[model samples]
Target: MGILNKFLEKTKICVIAEKYSVAVEYAKALGCSKKDTYFEGDKYVILWTNGHICTLYQPEDYDEKFKIWKVEDLPIIPNGFWIKVRPGKGQILNSIKKIIERQEITAVCIATDSAREGNLIGEYTLMAIENKKNVYRAMINALNEKEIKAGFKNMKEDKYYKNMTLAAQARDEIDWLLGTNLSRAYSVIYGKKYYVGRCKTVLLNLLCKREEEINNFKQSLSYGVITKFKNDNCEYAGRLNYALKSESEARSIVKDICNKQGKIDSIDRDIKSIEPESLYNLNDLIRAVNRRYGYAADEVYDIAQKLYEEHKLISYARTDSRYIKKSMINDVKLIVNCINIDKFSMKKSDINNIERFIKRCVNDEKVIEHTAIIPLEVESLEEKYKLLSTKEKNVYDVIVENFLNNFLENYEYESIAFLTKVENYTFITRQNKVITHGWKERKKQDKNIVEVKEGEYVNVEDSVVEKKLSKPKERYTDDTLFEVLENPAKFVEDTKLKKILRESGIGTNATRALLLKDLIINGYVTRQQKYIIPTIPGIELVKDIRTDKLLEPFFTAVIEQQLQQIQDGELDKDELIKDTIKFLERHIEELKSIVIPDKNNDPIGKCPICKRGNIVRAKDKGYGCTNLKSTGCRFFISKEILGTYIDEKQVKNLIEEKQTDVLRFKGSKGEFSARIIWNGNKTQFKKF
Candidate 1:
């Protein structure tokens, strides 16, 4: 009876949050009683982790040899990866396991941050459970009382999040495989800890490319002839249709057209409309904050997290999707009414006009995991604004405007493409007339307006030459870098690669800022005010390395997309791993070509499977790797296998070409000719 009573106590559901504060909100909304380190009610229990309690093991954790950097270890590709409890985090993981093991704890519901990384933490922590238990997912996008209740009411089976888990795992492994091997290879070659990364390498290369553009830029002067012409409506300036490289040429044209009779050859008028931009994904919000208030990407993320997790002021941060769900229309209605329109320069009338614009933001198909970041309907929202830090306020305003921009009407304008003929020269004049200020009025007080008519004769009042100088490409600020990562197609050249990158951005937006931060910490780049300038070491490192495929943004971005494909079950993770290994092999070859000094003299070159190992002859004992003794590498070729004699040149062929030319051998069945090859394992033979 006593055991049964304890088992009955397990009827309560468990909640796990990414942080204590979010867990507190979950507990409060569920009416749970506070415990020492958790909250418990008759039907619920809440637990939390300080972000992540477990993480993927480092390279050194796999083998002690990896602890010391060696160029000979050009690429360390693990057959399998492992995850362990983060250091100093074992206690919390223990507590979570203990709580989950209780008899009455019927099911577990993950309430971690709604993201790929958070899914990893939740699933990985649960690996500690000794027995199977029912699992659910609590998708709380906001920590408000209403959202928390709704999240619990709509709990889903944990299997629903399998894709998220897979994506995070794939990304982690990719990073580990690339970062560990490449960092070691470059650091050893460059004689410094270069600390290469999957994403940061591309980012560093972008900076270096930009630096080269600036250094190599040659400022040249060009001139154009401008003439002032008057019609009945107004006098306007028109430029010649062509550019002149010399001032004398521009002046000659100007002198010829001066005081000349001219007629408007033709004028084309058309009305054009520009729709408002989509709402705020975390990346979009970060870019906006950086542009307006100059906050770093990480800082904006921190503030946004605080808003979503603590203040209950915004939707989930770190989302890549920009469209709110069509089902969330009610939530949208609630939020717009709750915010202070007066502060955002929005009128009560504008709120009424939001009906049509609201349709543009709602799309069930576009919303993936979470909707765009949006302000929530909270009490004292206006008062909350006044108390926020200056930077916080700036970020909040951009997020709010991102949503509000939808409420405003589309900006409409009329453009006139006018052409005037002077002698044999054709002068072009273009003007924009504002048809509807719409959203434009919210930002600008003045709209440049000019009206023109076709076939109108006019006299040239004056003509002069105008000189212009081209400017070098601008350096990347946090805003522009965020944009580049989201849309690298503009910079990338390959059509297929660019298309893939366009669909799946260069890196995960949630982690881009953190990776950028690592660049500075590792002495690759520096933040000069708004610019991410590459250091001398940074520039040299990019130039010195020759891992062409690994250095491309398209490679990293496509890997990111493949992770998504893995999540969607469209691609198998194991297959992705196998493909990655093949690519890693190629990348390692590229690194070795640049003289990754051999640490040992095994003569026959490096092992194709275990890249660090060297092949050597045991004096008529055939050939095997030197690392076979230390690392248990399985690489060997018997001098006489199946009545076939393997020679020195054959051993070199096996090492370099991964195979030896077909030779006669005696098998159990009959005499056969086959190629001795490293069949991804011990010695084997393949017949053609």
Candidate 2:
């Protein structure tokens, strides 16, 4: 009876935020001073979730047959997708479940991030708890006091975001259906671990195609005739439109034009207006930082997230929108006023036009789930800047600069084009002169002008024929690759397909960087300075699977489009899942007939005992003598020595030097350090 009374005295309202930091902020605003894993107030209890408390079940979770890799089990599509509490999250799940089950708790508030993934997180948590209470969504962009309060005051029913949850679930199930079945089939046929994904495979195909083009490219020599002309103490340069294939042809033209008088046939001048660039989305931000500071995409993302969550100096960073909502104009103005532009290296005149620039960034239709990443209205800008790391500071400065440019005037310039004729050949020269600095204060353009009037005669100061060779297309850097991934249609040949692909990119802005990181981690690609180059395995993988539908970027785009339709309520979720299953079943049969070529079997080293058979990699084992059956040489080494898996490089080192470098191993007692020594018949460890 006492326990029942205690349960009856539970809180009326429970709020669940996505992360601990966000929950703390919300708790402070909701008058919850006392704290534990959750903060308790008189009428409300504020709890936090660690990202996602639940995830889709793994393949083995569906059935025991999935434990082994077999071609027969090609398409493992479950009748219904099952949800499981992610490992290490059971305790939190139980706590939240108990709170939800409490009879006194009348309503629940989902104060997670304002995006699809956030909606999925909250909905999945509720589903895991088997919640049936009234659920409300507190959609707020930042974790500030004002926004949090406003979000609570204007909470919407959880059913409003049901479509978003369905979309997210569809994406997960589709990726699983394709990735799990295809990865296992290829790995089994090739005898190596080959992990595949829709986005990752398409990205790999792009890189491989580019690599092939680069490899097959042949350099061809070409010659150009360049001449310098002088008129009225001003000099200008021009190149002939035609490029000669032979040096003799170029020399003949240069000789004919040398020391000759040329007349300007026409001179055209026009004012060119350069508009300010759109604001930075996540993909654009990643590209900008990578190009400027050589920072990886993940590193920049982490820094941006820190700036948003810790410093509260910027809006949400994981956004794809480049424009703010029309309703945010007043808030944007406040943010602009809060920025101390005097501390930045900017002209006072540029600062005066802040209002005008701010108007350019406002567009209701352009805004998506979140607004563009802009500086927030903080109390002390200088103090926040000081607290940021080098990379964070760099990213903050970029956002601030872009925000300021919206208020500045357009960059104005004048282009002057001159067509000079000597004999029958025509040479064209062009120049640009800046009329107004405007946004160019941050990004300056080259201005090199030479005054020349129409029909004016000029002497050819000098003429030269230079021979050059055409180079292959440069390799993809992080900056360029991000752009391609964002808009893959730029490389597509078909006009209709390109238009469709541009609408739905290879991956979302939030996940494109992760896809690249995964490719590098999976040995599909390597980084050579700034460029991404495909490895031998990557090249072969592309060659082996190029003809399959899985390598088509458009196919992934179609899947993404259907998910978007699900979000918009234009398509039914069950129908989408059924279609995916049908597609997978058709492909799995086609995949079985294709023969995967065996990889090159490189011997580790010559056997020490027999000295006849070479040491080769043993299936699911470490290494073994190839003549074990022929010559009765039963020499083999286990993959794991002292509870640590030995890699190929370490195995080779042990065979050649009789010992490996210092290695760490975890035993039954505890983790210990040692060097693995290759004994004649067996291996032993020497403590380091």
Candidate 3:
């Protein structure tokens, strides 16, 4: 027998924490005796649920017929949801059951994190056990002694949070209903297993569209003429805004402007000030850590949570609020003073200017359920910080930077612009001058700004036709992808729908990272360095399923709006459930016929070296001959070479003609055009 299970005979109450680390903390603050994983106090016996000890039963568990996926039986809407103990959690749960069942235990405490999902986890676990004891909710914002004691003192009857529980349960069932049913219907059509959800499927569609756009994107090379001017003030260059359609036109413009006289038309200088970044909300923290350390959103969240739970080094990591109350300025200052100032290159004069910038950091209206993430005020923080892992320190530094930067002055600069005219052509140049090295402390560029009187004539020394290539939009990086997920309204065209989506987004702050992680785990998405790329299998899933109702952000936004209404008790949950089922029924019956290409059945082209084999997509990427096993042929082509993305048409042309048409490739010196030659033996690049 463990600590609480064996010695709970004298327990006055039992406590259930959301996670093990939290349970351990409660044990300390409650003066409980710890043994094994459970703790025993004079009045309280405590253990942990380890996050959702019980979850809803899967479709297979509900019935044997549902075990095998079939389109006919899809849209698997259950009559009622039931909870069962999750796998591998039976031992701790049994221990908890034993602890709570003791006659000495008069009441139970639900000390889980204060959130909708946390409420669900605790409520579901209790529901699975069929506990009859009186239950109370302990909403803990921090894991300190004062906060824990305050939480217990202010604990309310579980019945008081019934709406929150109901809201969470409704969301849980709706997600299970939608994700489980829709994934099954789509997988059947895909001819292989595929995961799909309202949020992730749309994200996958966006990724696949990006991949297609990149492959189909053809760079149009254009030329422009620039006149280099040399005068007593400085040597500078400028150009007209228009791009020359043909090289001959650019050459003619250059010839006309070379060695010609140009007069300064106007000179404008303006000073501007940029404020420091806002406090670290969950989204902002995720973006900052991802940008600075190349960590994914999920990893950043995990690290941030560890900092919150284990070290108690920062406030709540899952908060959405980027503002604190105006009264918390002293609290923020305490933190800044506690931490070592070695990394922060602050100005001494900025210390007296703290009151000037305090307005940017504090706003009572913006403060929500929790305050912004800031370093906890502690004297030992500097010592404890040195023992942290590099990643933890990196994420911590970003939070600290955001907090400390608020005390500094605004980043101010001066922008000087000049416009020049040579004959009928006009040109412009801009130079930025740094004034205040505040938050960013960024320096000026290499270009020098020179003074010029209006209407003063200057000599155009030389001119040349500048070749420019306008490429397609960049691939989706984690940073950009997170932004899109947070603000999905950008993907839609309707202004009203955009407004709704901006309010609720695709997913909640808590679920966004986990959703992205699940997509990556199931092979629908992947991380190629900083980019979140959609795989070929991922592309095949959403290639033809895209429609305005399904692909647009409005779809998920409507679900969010309905869920919010249900949470607010404005609409009956059963009504939402009925509408969801009807939606599934309509969508399943109306699913578009998408031709998922079978590579084995439909190859791109025949292999040039080995005519017996057909070229198809390789495992990771690119294309390779199918007869590599039988004939030992090694013919293959990559998707990219020298930073240029290749298309399927190029692969087909290379196989049929034994040589490809001139294509652009990046060389060591610069970007150049080349042709691939298959000389009966191997491939060779023929550069122009």
Candidate 4:
């Protein structure tokens, strides 16, 4: 029995929210006469909806609409977007419907977060249930007891959230109008399946644009010089390239100056102001985890999701804001105290500095609804600290330490720049040495800068004049994903729309991670080692439609503004949809005129079995012999072995040349050569 059941005897309410744990908490907050909500809280049943319980029908999902693409019937805006209980979700929806029809229930409370999507789900479910029960809204932002209890005491009528529902409905309608119609438009005009969606298209455009940069980038060779010195105890590292140009020149200089004593010509040292790092926004956290632990964006997301739903220690993990709400201030303090209670304590100086920094950043308006993800309570914090898996533990510590450091002192450090005189040449050396670690002392071992003293000639061991090259622009990673999402215009070279999309980029934080995953899975992009390299398909897609403004960030930024206007009631939703459709239709027609190479020409290699046909790659399944249908060639290859990725070139070599080039395998095993010999009949590796 939930709180609602205890209040209204024999009562039951169906909870529908995207987050399951939050839904269960809302049920308990409504009325908690029972313990163990998932197993025994029968009086108030809590249910959940994943991002969407239903989506607009894909063109093929519709009966005659499925067979072919036709522009005449398009801008094939459906009469009205119908919502079916998603397949496999029908039973759950029906169970909730049955609960709604029970005689003892006096009313239904729409228990969901206070957001546009939440309101849409409530309104849709109400319409679907057919039960005309009295309705109240239980809108809470956080799942913590205090917030949930406070929300129940101030439950509002469902009518108060009508605008939010309208907003969500408009969002769905826009995606349907754009995705379905444009997808069909491109398919008919270009004769290939090209997709477009409110957010998906913008994301695809981002990947395509980045692909262009990587492909066209020119790499130039350069050089740098490093100096070697050794004192009795310490070994230091310094770049000598600050003196000369080419690696050859630096090497010559180093050879001449090796026996000469270099004097510290001048030393400039100053206090460097270090502000505490901002709280972890979802993207920031994902980026950090990827950097620190080698977790992919999706992997970290899964861990965070598990921590949020299963462990119930963290708050919502989907938000972009790093600021926490004023109501959460005390809770934040408690969490900080819990982490630092006995294990760690701040020095008085660090305490003062951090307090000043916190005062500067902590503002009521900066946070909305809830703060950045933090533990729900002290007990939960302690429980999470003990129960987390090693990987989870690392992520948890990052959040906790950052949360604590936010309230600690600023890291005051001294940066020293010096000019050393060596053989009548002045060498520049810049060093950022920490004078006071302050908040950084929380993770002292991970400090990037070391302490240095004025007039001290520390040994810079292992000096070399290494030839270097000016590398091309690196591909997008989880970190760069946020950067693009934050300032997409930086890449576009557009003055007008760049200014508009500068704030909210191409898509919201909630959808950015998912969008990146989709691009990779759909073959638009892939990770080459650590780089998110765009495939031939991704590259050509952009090259084929470079002038199409719809493929640019500025266009999406304009759409975002229009969407905001609709949400704010300043612009009509129908009018906005009409304008978006017109823009997309124009782009689709233009792109249709552009030629795209048949994707089949970009081959993995000739089929190993057929010897005359090509090999093709498919998602889930790897490369397959494309001659399978005509000549019964059914050979295929695996994409990875153990955890290491084997590239397409290697695959091609194994099938065409019968050997992979010499490679170094990590382990005591050393360098080896892999070969698929005897006409692809056997695989073997021998030491090189």
Best by lDDT: 2
- Which window of ten consecutive residues has the lowest lDDT sum in model 2? 1-10
TM per candidate comes to: 0.81, 0.84, 0.86, 0.76
lDDT (Cα, tens digit) per residue for candidate 1, span 196-228: 777887888888787666544556678998899
Tens-digit lDDT track of model 3 for 1-688: 2223533556577888988899888888889988777898787888898888989999998898998888888778887998888889998788888888999988888888787888888898788788998888888767767567767777777887777788788888888987898778777776667677777777787787776666455668799877788788767888775887899988988877877899989989899998888887888889888888889999999999999899888887888888887766776667666776467645333566557546776788886557788888866777888889999999998898887777777888889888889988988877787787777755555346576788888899988789998776677877787788778887778889888888888777778899889888998787766878776567766754544555666787787777777666687878878887888888887763455566544588888887889898775468888898988999888866665555577788888887776765546775566788888888889875
Full candidate order by TM-score, most accurate first? 3, 2, 1, 4
Clashing residue pairs, backbone N/CA/C < 3 A, model 2 = 357-406, 357-407
All candidates: CA RMSD (Å): 16.5, 10.4, 4.9, 7.1
lDDT of 4 by residue, 39-139 (tens): 12545556565545555566666568556777766656565566666677666567667666768766667766566666777777767666598777776
Provide the overall lDDT of each model, using Cα atoms, as 2-decimal numbers: 0.78, 0.80, 0.79, 0.63
Candidate 2 C-alpha lDDT tens digits along 500-524: 7888888888788888889899988
Question: Given candidate 4, what's the lDDT at residue 260?
Answer: 63
Backbone clashes under 3 angstroms, per model? 4, 2, 0, 12
